[model samples]
Target: AVTALRLISPSTALRNLGAATGIAGFIVASLILIFYAIVAGWMIAFCLSSVANLLGMSDFAAWLTSFGLWRNILFMLIFITFTIGIISAGVKDGIERWSARLMPALLITLFLLVAYVLTLDGASEGLKVFLLPDFERALSPKLIIAALGAAFFSLSLGVGTMLIYGSYISDDENLPVVGGLVTLVDISIAVLAGFLVLPAMYVALHNGVEIFTPTGALISEDTLIFTVLPELFATMGTAGIVVSFTFFFLMGIAALTSSISMLEVPVAYVIEEHGLKRKTAVSAIGGIIAVASSTILLNFENLFGLVVAFTTRYSQPVLGFMFCIYAGWVWHRDTLLQELRKGNPDVEQGLFWKIWPWYVKLVCPVIILGIFAQSLWG
Candidate 1:
């Protein structure tokens, strides 16, 4: 769908985002990308922690505590360096190859972890909570609103990411089938993550770790991930180190997949617009991101929190609406149909094809606008 954004000026194809909207998208995306490294830095930090545990570093925690800023800088530096290197290697060798191996392995690791957690004493309760949604809470206005925002974020929709990847697809491939497959895999991973993490949460509770704060409210996400989960692993003794290492390593790879895609958007634009080589473009973008990430890392909570709120509360949903509007209204009706019909060039316009034009134009904007208004001002 996003391919259309890059499609109008088709010579560069996957290498370009649209003119005005493209710039707007990049500016909006810049916020999320900067803070996202902090999130990714957490993964790298945990992975390093796991490695230290494996090597029997007695004072690793003390060392990390004393040198927290520098330690984070190192991880963030490594993360940016490796991410830029991978993307600069070009799509087939870099993105696609790593994705082929990492995505499958990510799923397997998640399943195995889920299976292991399910064997714990309190696992069944976790499963019940995950599997059975609380309809009452779900029906609440707040929850419904959150779910709507979540849908956009989880799928990485409304970002030009889809457009970037869409340009990568070969013309002979069936877009609908491919899109559906990608979506299903994404949903599967989310479900599996819940299966894994929720069970671990219950297990943590069974081990007498607090899932909630002393004030009786739920603990913050950062505390749950960095503190509570590690405590859960501590209870398992020696074996937990290996398990924890594996879990964090799995997550690090998962985070890389998303990071690479985010980086590629601006990287592609630079390459096309400036005529720089892939490596040069990647380096330029990497340096920019690294500078931004370093500032956030150094500033810690206040600036980081502001960027997160801006991206989640304002930029992302707005950009998503823009993508929806452009797709539905700006691009010609026949063009979308043609793109959809790439693998099946002669496909007839049934009721679906007939209604879709008007649907995306009329329905999608209204729905997105409603969600955006609700999320921001409602």
Candidate 2:
């Protein structure tokens, strides 16, 4: 974290490492950001569709689809514009403020939805299915590999997010303590969200809304959430209408937060490294993403699948592996020690300082490399 902050100043972190690695990481991160924006556009699109259901617009989706790909392009454009507006405000007034406010509201809204679902007939049954793990599937090589990838993606590990965030954190803050708390809070939210969504899924199932096909395979995951759930909730009249609106609004906010962070990376690089104004940096990058998203929207089938496969299976894991390796091996040991010990003298004398850097050097890189292998071949 400290290294990233120190590096993210006027110099990009990857650039600080070296040009070849820096350019490679930058390309991967940029491509991922582009794909992410388009995927998130679906959330905004669904929010629109969900709201239409609440407002008694029966033919909204069908009618929208009549325009073919142009319909999706419209939502993507709106999503990109909305994200650019938030991120262009820069970090404190924009990203940090929205995160602080919307995260709590999102939690409260989730809990409220969970409470309503609990009142339904099959809520308990849904909870049971979610809580009970299928050990065989869980232990499968494919699932294990996927879970590892998910862990990296969820935490944004090796993604330079921590490095960027490190630059913003105050000197007096206890890094270890704060990092631990964040992990705990993130885990709690994930579990709570599962409790909320799974029970609602069960309730929908009980109401005879189909989530699975006759062959017992899950149906279109997107169809289940964005389309069916809102449609099901809309049946309950006024209170359900409120819930539908809140649910989609909550989803939109979540997508906004993620988009903000992704857009920030390159924007920050341009602003700091090239000495461009923040607004200029944001507008320039936003145009690039908007154009990239439009191209993907036009070729949604082959291009979309190719982007997803390359980023997830190839680029992300490889970058993550390279990051761990660089932090462990390539970066000077004393520099790393200094970064870790900043603002906390005790850290220098502690077991963490004694053990962690070497562990990161020796252990972490190997593990990440193994995971990269698994992601490809396992």
Candidate 3:
């Protein structure tokens, strides 16, 4: 009874659990943000600059008007449905299990498609554009900032989502190592996506196509893969269908993974606060998102217009600022240190432990606040 009481005490398990939850939430949310932003950004960049020209559109804006918005709305709906369904299945059964299967399939398909694209007439040019970065184009501070934000956001580093997931984890696991591993995986996928799209752009542009804008990447997401890529793939003849399926399938998987994580956040909130059954909460949230997605489909043009209107707006810096505050301010440093050092008795942890108090108390706040200010001003 004494041991149980001690374990369940307000300051021990409950406190640790709360900290862990916050860590998990941060990781998950940031990762989703990072992956989504990178893939979508790369796609936007390519379609706007190169692919549109290949399609022989005299006026890109006119082409966009003809594409309709409902297609995008349908995509958002599918994305939400697939995501919520996975969470509803339970993590072990849904996330890990389904991903284990789908991830392999996605990779295999991507490899096959890449091989085929490599055999195309413009393959050399495609390889050059993607592999050799244009230092001048990529050297901008804005691009660097965007990349960093995309990295942090996609990796789920700063979000409460990671912390929440961490709450469910045992104390013995090393948070830093696990965090690093997830980040690596997230980045690897983003790079792989670049390989996929840049090659396609090279081929499409080889035919005198001018898809992208002069200054930077831009596009209607609805027309992106469906309109743009399809035209490029058509140049591949019968092989295009196979390539198209693989490309869409890969995209679907990425979207699915990110969407599931998003759904998990609200679901976690409901379960922790309302004491509702996890299954019920998942279903309720899923239903709500599904409805929202459907509405988006009903007015696809407005959805696209709105998304584009607010397009360049990035989520990483915003979310990162929130995270720095949560981890550095709302949560106490001593509590965090004790939680961090639970299993590492031999390691010299003084520098980190000692510096963290000030880091969290002063540095993190200043950095995060500065980002917000810069973003507002920039």
Candidate 4:
């Protein structure tokens, strides 16, 4: 199967451009993993801490949740190591199997947590705020741009991760249908998450935890996961410990799933392009990312937010724009049509066949560039 790097065009120069795009994507993915691992480590730490709480080791649990440099580094290494171990085992045995098991578990846990949180006092207010959008604020260009970024990043659109994953799909699968289902699932999970988080925030406030500032902004908006939710759990007594454990465990699974894709982008590149063994690629790439993660941890005050903004805010949309260009303009139209026909011979008569070619070719590139320009200068 052709890798993402080779998917752009048959022409030599355009193929090199595709390779450069892939490399840029690899770099951005690495940068994202640097900080992403740190937060993922927090999820692991919180999971263990909840277990400690369950065992009545309150002090140990507190220390585990504390933002200690050593604790952060330890859990970060552990998370990266787990990622390496999984990818090293190869895709069918490692990625597919674990993802098959964990994703369902993650969803089940999310549903249960949402149900429980909604039953708490003040949760109705949160539900109202979440479901009832304020049109005035929603129309803000800034909010719309941010929303676009969130959607793209959440779906891993700009990254070669999805492109690489697509290469694994059998030719018999309908690409549009598969892509739609994936999008639906992703959006459902995100919405379900809001059902849990927003109501839980209000519940925390009801339990006397500080959730809002004087200006009505959320307190510790950036650190809400590590702060408000834990305090909210503490208010629930024994049940809180169980809930906290379940919640953090859910978070850990989510982190692991996402990190696997990010790491796979580069690992796939090295394995396919450099002729390296999967294990060697996983270890070398994972180790280098781990070192970069350590660097961020060491200089947390300075580099953390900078890297986050650079990768997610700036780099992602730009890469996504490039993907739109390659897909819509560079890739031959007949080839794309032929590829679509592999799964459905009558696809040419379908609505997607009629709309998508032009939509992706013209509409997608324009929308992506508009988003990029807004984010850049807005």
Q: What's the CA RMSD of model 2 in angstroms? A: 3.6
Task: Give each model's clash number.
Answer: 3, 0, 50, 0
User: Evaluated with lDDT, which candidate comes out highest?
Assistant: 4
Q: What is the C-alpha lDDT of each candidate?
A: 0.77, 0.72, 0.57, 0.89
The candidate 1 region of ten consecutive residues with least summed lDDT is 9-18
Higher lDDT: candidate 2 or 3?
Answer: 2
lDDT of 3 by residue, 127-206 (tens): 88778888997987666654655555465445455655566567887666666687787777677767677777777777
Q: Which of 3 and 4 is the better model by lDDT?
A: 4
TM-score of 1: 0.91
Model 3 TM-score relative to the real fold: 0.72
Residue 188, model 3: lDDT of 79
Error of 1 at 40 (Å): 1.4
TM-score of 4: 0.96
Which runs in model 2 stand beyond 4 Å of their true positions? 1-17, 61-67, 222-224, 227-231, 234-240, 349-351
What are the models' TM-scores? 0.91, 0.86, 0.72, 0.96
Comparing 2 and 4 by TM-score, which wins? Answer: 4
Worst window of 10 by summed lDDT in candidate 3: 1-10
Clashes of 4: 0
Winner by TM-score:
4
Q: Give the alpha carbon lDDT tens digit for every residue of 83-196 in model 2.
A: 788888878888888789878887888788777778888889989988999999888876776777777766666556655676788877777667778779778877987887
